[model samples]
Target: METEQLYREHRSMLIGLAYRMLGSAADAEDIVQDTFIAFAQVSEENVRSAKSYLCKMVANRCIDKLRGSASKRETYIGPWLPEPVITDDGGSLEGDPLSRYVHKESLSTAYLLLLQQLTWTERAVFLLREVLDFEYDEIAEVVGKSSVNCRQIFRRAKRGIGEAPLATPSLQGKTMELVQRFAEAMQSGSVPKLLEVLAADAVMRNDGGGKILAATKPILGADRIIRFFMGIQAKSEGAYSFAFTEVNGLSGIVTLKNGRPHGVMSFEVRDDQIVNLFYVVNPEKLTLLQADRIRPIA
Candidate 1:
C-alpha cells in the first residue's frame, strides 16, 4: 500500500479519535498534522505497519494533550466542553471520509463531557473498544498496555457508565424531541408542563467557574429542579432572558441579561425524559452563545 493512500484513508478516523480523547477540535487537527510530520521523518524500511504506527502516533499525541488540558482545566473559568460539530449522516465515522461527525445527541456534547469522568486511559480504551469496536488487542497496542490491561481499563470505565444522565432516551430521536419540547416550554413560560418532562431522578449540574452565581454542587430531583427554574424566572424581569440554542448537538438554553449572555444550559436525557440538566452559568463559557444560536437575538 502507498504511504500517501494509507494516510489519506485513515486521516479522519485518527482525527476523530484524537478529538474524542482531547475534547478539542483545533487540538485534534494539530495532533494529526503532527502525526504525519513525524511519519514523514521516519524511514519506510524501519516502519513495519503504517496503520499501526499512525494510529499510535495520534493516540500518544492526544494523551499528552489530555494531560495538560486536565491539569489546567479548572482555570478555564467555566463549563469547559467539547466543540460542537454538525452532522448530516447517521452512522459511525468509518464509512466515508467525507462524512462529518455530528455533535447531535448520539454524539452529543453531553456524551463527550461524560467521557471526561473516566481517566485518560479509560477514555481512550472506551472510545476504541465501545464506539469504534476495535479489538482489545489492537487497542492495547495503541495505548501501550497489555491486552489484559486494556480489557480491565475498559471494564472500569463501563462500570461507571450512566453516572450522569445527559441525553434522553439514550436514542437520538427521543433525545432531540424531548429537548425541543423543553425549549418551547421555556419560551412560553409553561412551568408546570416543564416539570412534567423532568425525571424524578433529574439532577442539574451547574458550572459557574466560581465567578458567577451558580450551584457549586449537583442539584438533584425534580422538585428541586422546579424550584431552581422558578428562582431564575422570578429574577428575569428585564435584567435577563433565556434563549434556546444547540450546544455540542444537545439542546441548550442560554441565559442573557441586559444584552449579554450570562450562562448556558444543556441536558442529558434517559428513558425519554430529562434525567440530567447542566447549566453553565459562568460568563466565560457563554462567550460563544450568541454565535451558537440558530439566529441572532432580536
Candidate 2:
C-alpha cells in the first residue's frame, strides 16, 4: 500500500496514541504528521507491517517530545493540566469501538496525569502493551527493549501509577445529572448544594498557565473548594456562562464569556459524588474549542 494510504488508514489511531503518551493534542498531531513524512521516505519493501512500523515511529517521536518537555513543565505556571481534547464522537479519534475505548480510558485528564509520573520509556511501554494491546514482542520491538525487559518496564509503570485500573464506566444519565446540578449550585453560590455533590475530600485543580487568575495550588477539601467557588462567583458575577458537555468521555462543563471560549472542566465521579475536578482555563489550551464553536447551553 502507498504511504498516503497507510497514513489515512492509521492516522486517527496514531494521533490517539501520541496524544495519550504526550498529553498534548497539538504536539501529538505534529509528531504524527512528521512520522508520516518519515514513513514516506522509507522503502515500502523494508516494512514488514505498516501498522506496527508506524506505531513505532509515532511512539519514538512522542517519547522524545515528552523528554524535552519535562523541564518546561517543571517551570510551568500554576497547576499544569493536560491539554483538553474533545472526545465527542467526531472530535478526536474515529468512532470505532476500540478507538472509543482508548479515548475514554487513556485520554482522560486523570489518566494522563498519572502517566506523567512514569519515565518516558515506561510510559511508552505501558501504553503500547495496555492501551494499544500490542503483544510483548511487538512492544519490545517498538520500544527497543527485550520482551522480558518490556514486561518489567510495564510492571514498574503500573506500580508507579499505583496499579489502579482505569475508572469503570459510570451511568451516563446519573453523571450528567450530577454535572448539571453542580453547575447550577456554583452559579447560584449555594454552598450547601455544592457540598451535597462534592466528595468530602474533593480536590479542584485549575490550569491557568499564568495567563489568567487561578489557584496557584490545588484547592483541597469540599469546604475549601466551595468557598473558592463562592469567591469566584462574587468577583465575576455576570462575566461567565457555562454549558454542559462531555469531556474526556465523562460529563463536564465548558465556561464561556460573552460568547467566546473561556475554559473547559472535566470531572471525576465516584460513588455518585464529585471526587476530582479539572479546570483548563489557559487561553492557549482553549484554541481548538474556540475554533469549533463548541455547542453552548440551550
Candidate 3:
C-alpha cells in the first residue's frame, strides 16, 4: 500500500496508542507524523502486516521522545494537568476494546495524574502492560527491556497508582446519566448537590505538569475534594465556565476561564457516583484537546 493509504488506515488507532502512551493528543499526532516521515524515506518492498509495522514505528518514536530530555517546565500558572483528548464518538461504549476501556481502566484525569508520579519508563511499561494489555514480552520489546524488567516496572507502577479505588462493569447508560447530573450540578452552582454525586472517598488530581499551579499531590476524600472545587470556583469569581465533553471515549468535563479552555476533567465512575475526578491543566498535554491541528491529518 502507498504510505499515505497505509497511514489513513491506521491513523486513528496509531493516534490512540500514542495518546495513551504520552497522554497528549497533539503529542501523539506529532510522534506518529514523524514516524511516517521516516518510513517514507525508506525504500522498502510491500510489507506484510502493515498495521504491525505501523505500531512498531509509532512505538519506537515514542521511545525516542522518552529518551530526549526536554528543557525545564515553566513556572506554573496554576495546577498543572495533562492535556485531554476526545476519545468517545458520542456512541455507546460497546465496541472495540480501546474505545470501551477508559472507564474500566480508571484512566480518567485522576489516573493520568497518578501516572505523573511514575518515571517515563514506568509509565510506558504500565500503559503497555496494564492499559494496552500487551504481553510482558511484547511490552519488554516496546520498552527495550527484558520481560522480567518490564514485570518489575509494572509492579511498581501499580503501587504508585494503587489509590484508584472503584468498582465497575456498570452499564454506560447508567454511568453517563450520573455524569450528566454531576455536570448539571456544577453548572447550576449547587456545591452540595455536586458533592452528593461524588464517591465518599472521591479523589481529585490535576496535572499541570509542573508548568502551572496545581495540586502537588492527590486531594483525597469527599470533603477535601469538595473544598478544593469550591475554592476554585470562588477564585474564578463566577467567570469560570465548563462543558461536558466526550474524551477518550469517556464523558469528561472541560473547564475554562474567561471563555478560553484551560483544563479537561474526566471521571472514574462506580455504580451511580463519580469515584474519582481527573483534571488536565498542563498546557503541553492540552494540545490534545485542540479543535484545530497545525497541519490537518492526511
User: By TM-score, who's the top model here?
Assistant: 2
Q: Is candidate 2 or candidate 3 better by TM-score?
A: 2
Per residue, candidate 1 scores C-alpha lDDT tens digits across 1-298 of: 6657877887877877887887666677788888887888888886666766787888888888877766688676445556543333234434543244332224566778779888888888888887667888888888889999999999999886665433343455566677667766766778777887899889887777677767767788988887887787787666655555555555566666775766666677777688878776655444433333333234
Error of 3 at 103 (Å): 12
TM-score against truth, every candidate: 0.72, 0.90, 0.70
Candidate 2 Cα outliers beyond 4 Å, as residue runs: 90-106, 163-167, 171-174, 290-293
Q: How close is candidate 1 to the true structure, as a TM-score?
A: 0.72
CA lDDT, candidate 1, residue 37: 76
| lDDT comparing candidate 1 with the true structure | 0.69
> Please, what are the lDDT tens digits per residue for candidate 2 over residues 1-298?
9887887788878887888788777787788889999999989788878888899999988878877878988999989998886555445434433235345454557878999888888988888888888999988778878999999999999889885435346444566788889988877777889989999999999999999999989999999888887778678746777877667666778887766678899877778888889999998887666334256666
For every candidate, C-alpha RMSD to the true structure in Å: 4.9, 2.8, 6.3
How far out, in Å, is residue 6 in model 3? 1.0
Best lDDT among the predictions, by candidate number: 2
Could you arrange the candidates by TM-score from highest to lowest?
2, 1, 3
Between candidates 1 and 2, which one is better according to lDDT?
Answer: 2
